[model samples]
Target: MATFAQDDDGVVVIIGSGAGGGTLANALAKQKIRSVVLEAGKRHSLEDIENDEWAMFKKISWLDKRQAAGGWHLTENNPTLPAWIVKGVGGSTVHWAGIALRFRDFEFRMQSINGDIAGANLLDWPVTLEEMAPWYEKAEKHMGVTGPSTGMAYHPWHNSFKVLATGAKRVGYKEILSGPMAINTEPYDERAACQQLGFCMQGCKMGAKWSTLYTDIPRAEASGYCEVRPQSMVLRIEHDAKGRANAVVYADASGTIQRQKARVVCVAGNSIESPRLLLNSASAMFPDGLANSSGQVGRNYMTHTTAGIFAVMPKPVNMHRGTTCAGVISDESYNDPSRGFVGGYRLEILALGLPFLSAFLDPTPKGWGKQFTSRMEKYNHMSGVWLCGEDLPLENNRITLHDSEKDQYGLPIPVVTKSDHPMDAAMRKHGVAATARCYEAAGATDIIELPPYPASHNMGTNRMSAKARDGVVNKWGQSHDIPNLFVSDGSQFTTSGGQNPTLTIVALALRQAEQIGRLLNERAI
Candidate 1:
């Protein structure tokens, strides 16, 4: 039995105020819709974000003694996987590298091109790229995006990006400057431009890179409609006898359980947590899960399989001078029948590391002698190209409730069961070859390919489609079964595109918020 706070006025409850939730909160506020955003982590101030690596991690990330913190799904279940996620007010966006790229038009229509591959359930998006184009532009503008558009041919590529382009040209590979990241080149929306500190992942001190904490939540609060409850761990959404969701039950920091009622519910918790919440909310009305009429709430999980290839250049490239990823290789991103693989990969150029991470990621053994110090000294000149390839959405690669393990809050732990895709091995081989060619063109000396790992940009679980039988949500991110229930996160992705999914997630959330607002307004009328 939970104590209830009788709330009369209707409020849209958004769970997990990260990239998607925060963006939707801002959009909903703009439309005069009141909202309450429930975030598991504490709100971080600008002062909390400093320059030091360890200190920055302590503040912005789920590091330190509290390893199993449940603010956001930070770790992949397997130790072999390299899924380094963050948790805080801004969620993973707090420690993001901030390389925002929209998926190409073909990405949405993947299933139409190559119908059901073996061991994969590839599906086309309910919405088209053209429908999302305006929303993408809206998200870019709202987030104070930087970089030149393909339409505006005047602005040349940045210095760091130009070098990559030059190198790619030498190797007979065409590289395009990734248009419009959610980072500012010129100060927009009162945020400063990027200072080329090469520390975007460590939480930008200059507020150049857009995070939900600094941008959306504040604006949403100012609208007098959005209220954020920090350190609030939502256990489950409670429903009435009518089968309509009425309130959210959560435990606060002090272990005090409370309930807050809302007309509508939107579970924006990441790919893993969102599915866990849905599966946990099993009532007499919804035995399987709330809004899980299709029984696909925890299926079709997609995560990127990433590999790193380091290149040692003769001239010190000064890799630690700017952003982690300034440019990418996209020549082989499309589905080509000649390649013998359905999906392709992207080569995102990155600054290798400074010292600690470099030493850890490096394949060489660090002996505690003069040889160790000598090897550590060369960490500065090391730069690498991160090869990110799409893993097909397989039903077997799913996230479910661990029947045995439980969290600190006594909730069932998230259990992830993943297996490598058949197309991955061949795709990785091509990636290694392309990486070597790119490095050779850049006048690299010793080029080494690092061990493969999960890229951590995980998606799917609660997907959108034309019908409830096909997916959990509709085209507008509304639950196909439940009219008021909604979702805004990476979990709503139907197709995991070749590029990073954050920007597209933000765009879709913004688009969904508008649609949700209209639906609410129509219902009120």
Candidate 2:
């Protein structure tokens, strides 16, 4: 057995250091609380970021050559769906395109507007959008957002907002700047302003994007109260005979086993790995999983279904020269009762992708040689929008233990069980016409919608609610079954919002961190 480190007094163990964990670490540090963050991936530097898409697709993610065999795998039970989450210090935020859109007020009350689907367990959020607004504003200010506050873009702080507004208005639709993003356009919080490099998806080497490593984590570390341990993958939450989490078991880079004690454990390992960790921590008290009294540890998995629609314009748009989603057409965010679907979608204009990826969105004429070449030469000025719709939460869609597969640390791998409910498909169908309308309004020539891909925005496994029977965590994201254990990640969401869930996740983490800090100061934990 590897030697264990001396446990620090009043130490809070935080798993995963993405937006949630990083933000909470900083918040707790402000209250003079010490935290130890355990991250599965190593810290990547600016040197790791390259210009090539192929290198980015491989390097930015955790699909290193040696571990590629044991990397995340999709299943036939889940059908065509695939898992695309990154594992690292900043997690998938490193590769994200950085389009931050706040969910409309309607998203907090999905069940109230329309009854639940037959197979789905859709419900309203424990907290409303109003409760989250201040935190959203806090997150915006912390990240130094720059955008316009109008139609699609609702915040006027960013300089790019006006430029996009003009583009949207030329097509007859009132263009509004999107909500505050986590990018630095004018240099705030000691970070430099964005140069509009348009390589965010490949990783922002300039540190213009507000990733946790560059923002929250740095602040927390600077306070001298937080210790970030990278490349340490936790195997399980070690519980005492009384069923209370006392320490975490993990392996080092050399495959040496180690343990570290903690008074409180906060897990922020996203939707996929959070559930996997809990299920692996099963003991006599939690035979199924730790803090799984509701038997809902890994159920109700949801991801937004997205299809990219690219259009070829007549002018030299220079589409790939800026942010991925510079302009959006979200006239469809609110749920229209007449649409025949329970949910609605948002349409945001996307900058053109790389040539190989763009080919997937190309609508070339049948036949081959000459015809394909002719079409490609004509439509190179491609610009487009991504249509994202909500998928209802179904109990059958879950993340369970794989029969034989295990990770390097002898932990059972996550087996995802998923299928799009008919209502979900219908919602996507309902939004198609509206997507075409927006492109037509923008003078798109030869529009083509790409096939649906695995949504990176996954959430709602350990859902939060008012009662233990209806959810796993309470309104504060504290485990009802285990008072000292908390989950402050996307897995705690009761309803996956209509738009991008990153901003809300950040807001929720901040709110929960404050509450936890107060409770810890009073010795509640």
Candidate 3:
């Protein structure tokens, strides 16, 4: 609620108030650091959250004009809307399913372990799991992650999860459970426990699932060190003669351009917009893009190789009665090239309601005949898992500023170009077949394999690296070119680990905030 001056150069300006930005704001506020959080969309409170899928999509989703290219299914099915992220105060956390998982050790060392994957731009993260464990613990505790030692029990297995685990067991898999989720199994954080409502992606009405909207942003505001400005679409980053980022120009809620001075700027605008903002910030000193000396600012885009596998069970599964991401089967979450892929995947319960299912079940022209009708009719008897796996970073798989198109604010629209690595196709084919076998063992009368939907798991555009020449940011997420500038979102990822990105994004933000606070005190940055 506190408003600072437009020329307040001491404030750290954070763009996009999602998991990373919101979490970073609160973390910095805890240490009495002032920050301005500028979100692109209007704010929505818990009271405004609706359970209806289409209604909520219109309300929260960032339906910006993002074009898709390359061979990804989304290029064909969702070209103009390549991502399904939220644009409000909490960013995509408002639309997240709360299936939090930590990055495995091998994931952090992909380049070292994989020893050079052909055509895959692999790199070891500058920070290791050993170094990140404490931060992850802090994030887990702060977010009230539901699991052992957190004083919150794991979520009880819902019908969808039950079917998943049963099928997983039948297929010789063991790592199956319904949690480590940010959703509360019991009320811990001041919020109410989940009401067993299933419209999690629509925004949690109970506030049980952790979202920065009701959690971090409010906490940051309560600390009196953070000011959240909703509907402030940042158009460019500005710098002085020395080329240090000093301010950002954005359109205010009233559609008037405003410049907010900053001592430091953190771009936490998710993967797409984060890099887009940097590319749009191109200056005479850094003509390629701000902090883009390595030409990696908008390169190496990654969305986990993903698919939705729906099965028609013999009995009513009522999958839509509980959490959307009920549980995860992480047995496949390992680095096993013997499986025809360098990295692994996780099978988590994904229960989409009728409306979501109808649109995403299949996007082909022949999608609506008997096959679709049969599946639609058996909604009550359906169980499914979202197959999310590692997506190797390729330099060509990137987000680029469109040469011609621009948004309403006169910025070049970001074009997300993605395609499958041979590994991606192999991994997905294997994952789908394995998922089908599991469902078949559990008595699936029919199975429908769905192509990847608009990616909710975007990462690796402005990635971190030990060497400045290899990436945009360092181990601390501080830009190599501009020490005071940072990337606090999933964009800082070195690799797209085989799981959800939110937990890791929060962990990195927490760690980066500490580093930022320390550097501020030391006058190092």
- Error of model 3, residue 425, in angstroms: 0.8
Error of 2 at 70 (Å): 20
lDDT of 1 by residue, 386-445 (tens): 777766777766778877767777888776665657676677778888888876777767
Give, for candidate 2, the lowest lDDT window spanning 10 residues.
64-73
lDDT of 3 at 503: 92
lDDT winner: 3
The global C-alpha lDDT for each of the candidates, from Candidate 1 onward, is 0.73, 0.71, 0.91
lDDT of 1 at 220: 88
lDDT, residue 307, model 3: 89
lDDT of residue 310 for candidate 2 = 60
Off by over 4 Å in 1: 1-6, 62-82, 148-163, 359-376, 452-455
lDDT of 3 by residue, 44-104 (tens): 9999998899999999999889999999988877889999898788999999989889999
Worst 10 residues of 1 by lDDT: 64-73
lDDT of 2 by residue, 278-302 (tens): 9999987789889899899989888
Order of quality (lDDT): 3, 1, 2
For this target, which candidate reaches the highest TM-score against the unseen true structure? 3
The C-alpha TM-scores of every prediction are: 0.90, 0.89, 0.99
Error of 2 at 503 (Å): 0.8
